[model samples]
Target: MSTATARSNLGNTIAAHAILITWTVIALFPVFVILINSLKTRKAIFREPLALPNAESFSLVGYQTVAKQGDFFLYFQNSMIVTVVSLTFILLFGAMAAFALSEYRFRGNSLMGLYLALGIMIPIRIGTVAILEMMVATGLVNTLTALILVYTAQGLPLAVFILSEFMRQVSEDLKNAGRIDGLSEYAIFFRLVLPLVRPAMATVAVFNMIPIWNDLWFPLILAPGEETKTLTLGSQVFIGQFVTDWNAVLSALSLAILPALVLYLIFSRQLIRGITSGAVK
Candidate 1:
């Protein structure tokens, strides 16, 4: 309100943005460098590392090599299927479990919530011994099913915890009104509660998607077979095999980055907008 106070606030805002921009540039510089050079020829890449790709220097040889040598489309499909299926399970099961914990105060409810949420702090990789044994015992070691199940287990705990917190803040009166309207508990969850918690759900979806899309561990450990390889795993293997081939490696990295960048751009506004909006409201 006072002139001095307003000026001080403005100065702080400027400093914050300066820091943020600086860090963002630092983070993005390598990615930009890799992507631009992926389009340039080998000589151009080394000679003009900081230069933009010109029409005369630009070439599509990297992309051609990647596509010709590998079944990129198949890997893309595998990733899409696994990500979608795993996310569906996480959202449905996580939301249902969260709803039960929030709406009903049954015995062991708090304890169970705490139990499940422990997975957030404890990396599931620590239990690789048991997970692999279980997968092997069940004959699912090299299957996409194995990857989906492991990711669901890995993602569910955090999903339930975040959604449960959001569910707790859902107005009790609306739930009561649904009960008074003769709706079953299941119907109430489907129509009343689920609709209200969608913002948090979007937040959870985006949160889970990035890790799953970018993951290398589960694919390598659980489903390393050629037939079951996800895009991330495929790209990694391809890059390693072609490490000395700068064009191929850079192109592979670019391809890997494209889908993730597109998805982030699409959902970023929604993920940030509603989660904070809900909290503020």
Candidate 2:
């Protein structure tokens, strides 16, 4: 409130902004470099790597080459289906479980929550041998269903944990009021609690979508067929096949980066808000 105090606070704020900006550039500089160079001729790229693209330097050759050489659109679709379907089930089932855990004070509740959360610390990749055998035994190999089931299982642990934490903070009075109104437990969840948990749901969706979208391991193990390969796995194979083609390589990397960047930009606020609100911890 005093003049000197206010000035000192202002100086601290300026220093914090400067530090944040510095780190932000450090994080984004490599991505910026790749995108700019991907649009330039190879000669121009090497000669003026730091320069903004101009008409003389601008070329769509990389994109053209990537599009021609790879079925990028189909790969994009496969990734979308797996990511979306897995996320939907994770959020729905995770929320229902979270609501029950938070609302009920039953015996062994804490242990149950911890048991489900075990999958969070333990990477699902450790069970790859069993998962693959199961898929093969069930004749689901090279099928999107294989990838979807695996990702859904992998994502559920963290989703339930985060949603349960937030669910605990919901006012008890609301649940009591719903019950007083003769609302069944199912109606309370569907009509009242679910609507109130949107912020937490957005938080979970953003967190889960990234790993599922970017995963290569499960897709490679479960569904490497041309029709079923997700974007990340397909990109790896495509780049391997066209390793000598710099333009296609850069373009393929860019194509992979775009969807993730878009999702981050859209959901970043809610994701950060969730962490600060202690939804996970």
Q: Estimate each model's TM-score.
A: 0.90, 0.91
For candidate 2, write residues 182-247 as lDDT tens digits: 999999999988989898898899888888998988888889999998999989999899888777
Cα lDDT for residue 211, model 2? 88
Off by over 4 Å in 1: 1-18, 273-281
lDDT of 2 at 251: 85
Tell me the whole-model lDDT of each prediction, alpha carbons only: 0.90, 0.90
What residue pairs are clashing in model 1? none
Instruction: List runs of model 2 lying over 4 Å from the truth.
Output: 1-19, 105-107
- Displacement of residue 9 (Cα, Å) in model 2 is 8.1
